[model samples]
Target: MRTRLMEAGLHDGATWRISPTPFLLTSADLSAIQSLGQHLLRFTHALNRLYYESVRGAQPTWVADYLDQGKPPDLIAYARMNRFRTALPGVIRPDLILTEDGFMISELDSVPGGIGLTGCMGQAYTDLGWPIIGGRDGMVAGFARMIRSLHESREGAHSPVASAEQRVPAPLPNPPQPSAARLAIVVSEESKDYRSEMLWLAARLREAGLPAQTVSPDDVIFTEEALFLAGSTPLTALYRFFELFDLKNIPKSELIMYAVKKGHLALTPPMKPWLEEKMAFALVHHPALEPFWTHELGADTFELLHRLMPKTWILDPRPVPPHAVIPGLTVDGHSVSDWKVLASLGQKGRRFVIKPSGFSELAWGSRGVSVGHDLPQTEWAAALEAALASFHQVPRILQEFRKGRHVAVSYHDPVTDEIVPMPGRVRLSPYYFIAGEVGTEGASAGPPSAKSVELAGILATVCPLDKKLIHGMTEAVMAPCTLA
Candidate 1:
């Protein structure tokens, strides 16, 4: 393709900066252009038909019925005049034009427009100068030829006639561009130290020469004359039959920015009521939440959120749980009823591990005793009893001695704004005893190793709640000893 472009006079002598331009072409170019237009029209029609039929209540047989069902005149006018367009998967406006040398596609403004990078595929194909067969002049002709061949193969059994050219002599005029002044950013307030993060992100946007501001949900002012309030919160739904409402009056082209914390709050129910209403918004959260939002809310909604909140980015550092508590030593099977576990463990041996259920990072205490020796059993039992008596209400778990190396991992869940592994560091001091050497061959000797931190972070993101939550609850039960 590159060789062909060089062979032709396309890239001759003059230093020409490649750019997108509107142009007029000869009759041959127009014919090829018309062919491409027909192909795109068919594609659009098929797309709309599929979309309408796939909609929950829209039956495939009722397509014509719905079209004639007293819709607004503008909608009926489109269906009546552009029958082919109505048959497509979505509302698509195809703009085919003649460039100086060949045919070009001016636009494909579908129902959900402005598809960012994904929409650039056509231009990319053109720039590459993909070879054109069948007497075609340019990339547009190549695209048309490809679609024509596909259609022919599919219609081989049915022997269907090719679609007639429905190309408009001139391309439709471009819609008015949105004003740059209307741009804004929205963010979630649940983030820890959210204000600081917003300021930092806003500063970065300013540095990049983009006008951006971060506003929280509570801070948003939906004045009656400014914008429509269509979505309802949990509390609002009780009083209103439907969660959706229209303000009916607002200036056109006014963009209301939304910066949402992806996983912090349950937004699905509220958003469900406002599915049909369009609004400008974006979501920012840990990378883990990306898949959920993208898969659950369709690409269009995801793109809308990203565009309205460009400053949002995910920081996916490893995380460690905030707290952990391991049940202290117990006297036989007497449990808390006999004595306090911590005191028992402390008395039984000069060193004992304190592990909280459902928590990671074990704490160890050494009371000047050798590894092999044991403390007096009588003292151990008494201490356990005393500790158990002190904290009678809290639930606790007793874990068997786990002699091994320890590490931690961290992660973030965008669905719930809370950072997984709240405290980012895993406790590793006790692991040194199990390994014999304080500094193992592959592990860090000082504070928690980087690997442990990363592990804790990952665990925080993917670990099941039953496991992690139990650890947290255990930690809470042993909070007093954690401080001690």
Candidate 2:
């Protein structure tokens, strides 16, 4: 006898977010969130194959010279193309932090944005039957099989399209053909307030006939081949809701970046700003790359992401040899020689967060962060001298915060309308979709091919245990994560 996620509709008329009434999880926390979404999808394919084996010197040439310090060499050689090397990331979210030593993870997005509010709260709690966890249209069939595995990796990476009538009006889990070109989710002008949950996910893929919409980047146009909108129609799979540092205020973003660098536009999370970093979890706690991440992500997915990742650093300001210090921190016991000595401690000796390790607009939502016991010591030493004067351009990372863990939930009060229990502090997230394959072997994420990774919906949030900057949906207690 329960259902208060806005009476089972889960809100957002005009941002009336986070309330609660659907935060269960327990079939062993839903099989450890589907085995932590297949070990964080093999840790993003072993951090994109050990950052291309440190861009081929076979690992550790200062790991692709500190992730190509402030990147740009032709977008790091178009994210090391070997025709987009086993191209991953059709969708995969991971911000997790329930703590008390459980799901810490802290960041890994791949252009994430709550896909149509997790397929409209998993079809409103599985149409009231409620077993929800990637069933009940597994977040719209794992985002329609990751957009039909991006039209099976652009026509003939081993054909998969040419069915379901050149795409969209599918049979069940969307057929998605690019040959006729249609899908579009553009949204730029720096992610225009996530254009109302992508116009309610392009009105549920136009009520299943597909021909989805939700455009922006000035309603895209530039046609010499494709990318149309009010200018025509074309557009065969865009989905990028802008954030490779907002590609210079996107509008004629170089005509959809020279139409996906001349393949005639297909762009997924493929503009790879080093796969959107939080300093790739401080290069997975670099200590001279633990055996190239235990032989490129195995060894039980690098010891289960080195215990759900947390201890990170990457804040290089250079010049400091007064007999070295910073390795895995020491601070008050002496050993930190300048990050303005970790903003001259004090505030409970600052715990640490210090963000921005993405393309920049202060690195996607949560803007240039910098928590450290919630700022003060001269604004945490002016955010550590603007992350050490934008090290050659922009880079920052410090992590080691790990707090979130309160958990209760029952809000509905907008002026005592009733049902309010309030207790907060979650963050969960868990999305993992990935299917854009190239991993050959009769590869499939498209037609009759699936499970390269699935668990499509989780989100959660909660926040408020004396809030330390959680995120959107105001006061927090959001939902859609059931089982218990």
Candidate 3:
């Protein structure tokens, strides 16, 4: 089978390279894999519910999208297979396929490319001196484990419907390892922090016993000879064009995936337009300048979710105002006047929290103004002007105030959906002003809560445009072009 795939140009050195290890499995691996598959299914289901909630007003007609489409039978079969207490008799093939709607279990070979993380997992396991598993096989096992952990954790508890079971076979034998090959790591001088992170990941890969090298992006001059030797054009060549603009610090790598700062130079005018064409990349953090990047986070996450999921949804920030700004309310059959906006706040008698629309951190002296206390009439008017000015700088939203303790939930795929909650923190001073309180301690504690993650997951499933916008934003940031 592997030989046939190679002859068909499906293996490495042909067109799309198939990893050497295919379906490495043991009887013990089945339970873990099943659990992960189940979790992914549940998460997808939950996301679908959230999506429905998000687009209810905008596209009320498409409300029954999930139920109307119906579940793919392959997914049903795979779901059943996950619940089998004992290893099934037949050769179990876990074919989890991700689609726009959700994941369906398809033929094993039908999965898409860019799943190198599975190989990384295998390498990690091997480096740990565990029994060597084939790369492809390790991916299958690892994916199974990830799904199982996610399922058991119930992170998708918000899902409206429970996941149904399907029968799947037990693990097969270990496949052969592929011949050793040199993988390149592209780096640029400009992004030292990113370059350093890549180098660190490479070192970690090396510790996992994989041979890896870090090379400067500019240094990787692409020529016909080099391309011929590698049996193809080096992907790193794409980034070299940016050097014309003295963007020498940009890093490029065929083997290492790039991570760009969300709203920084990576997505500046010169680079964004060019990078959008390529689908080989994935973005890490959502870009600040482009709020839509958050939608694309689901693409990778959906790959993790689609084993047994019916659908998924994501939130659209457009309709909902930011939590900072207070929504205007109707009073006595008429809308409140602007003059009364602060007057209304004064009457509340509590500290009023002001936030710029879509912006998180409160501007200095603009954090929380205690009505009638910290804000006297003179000061209140001035602060109100400042808040309104800053709000107008972009889009602004306001929230009355959240005096409750802040906590965050982190979603982890551990063959169960694990939601870990931690305390949230706010910085009282800037790092330069108070290093300990503002810099390190504050930064670590500002992540969103578990409820936020759940909310985000739901929103992603509902809004299709959100996903497209996010992908566009991510590509723009990660694959910025250099000026000629």
Which should have the higher TM-score, number 1 or number 3?
A: 3
Question: For candidate 2, lDDT tens digit of each residue in 355-402?
Answer: 877777777667778787887789888888888788768878888787
Q: Give the best candidate by TM-score.
A: 2
Q: lDDT at 204 for candidate 2?
A: 63
Q: What are the per-residue Cα lDDT tens digits for candidate 3 across 1-484? A: 2243233232322222222222222343333343443333223223333333323543233332222222233322321221211111011123332233333421111111122333333344344444433332343332222222222222122134534221111121223122122234444554332344344434443444333444566454444323211343332111121211233234333211121111100111112111111000111111221222225224544445332322111111223333432123333445433433444445345244333322122211233322333456667566555545543232222323322222122222223444332222111100000000000100101111111111000001011121211111211111100011
Candidate 3 TM-score versus the reference? 0.27
Of 1 and 2, the candidate ranking higher by TM-score: 2
CA shift at 408, candidate 1, in angstroms? Answer: 6.5
- Local distance difference test, each candidate: 0.24, 0.68, 0.26
Residue pairs that clash (backbone atoms under 3 angstroms), model 2: 24-484, 25-483, 25-484, 26-484
Give TM per candidate: 0.19, 0.35, 0.27
Model 1 C-alpha lDDT versus the unseen true structure: 0.24
Task: Please give the ranking of all candidate structures by lDDT, highest first, separated by commas.
Answer: 2, 3, 1
Q: Which stretches of candidate 2 lie over 4 Å from their true place?
A: 1-86, 94-106, 109-121, 124-138, 147-155, 158-277, 281-340, 348-351, 354-418, 423-458, 467-478, 481-484
What clash count goes with each model? Answer: 45, 4, 67
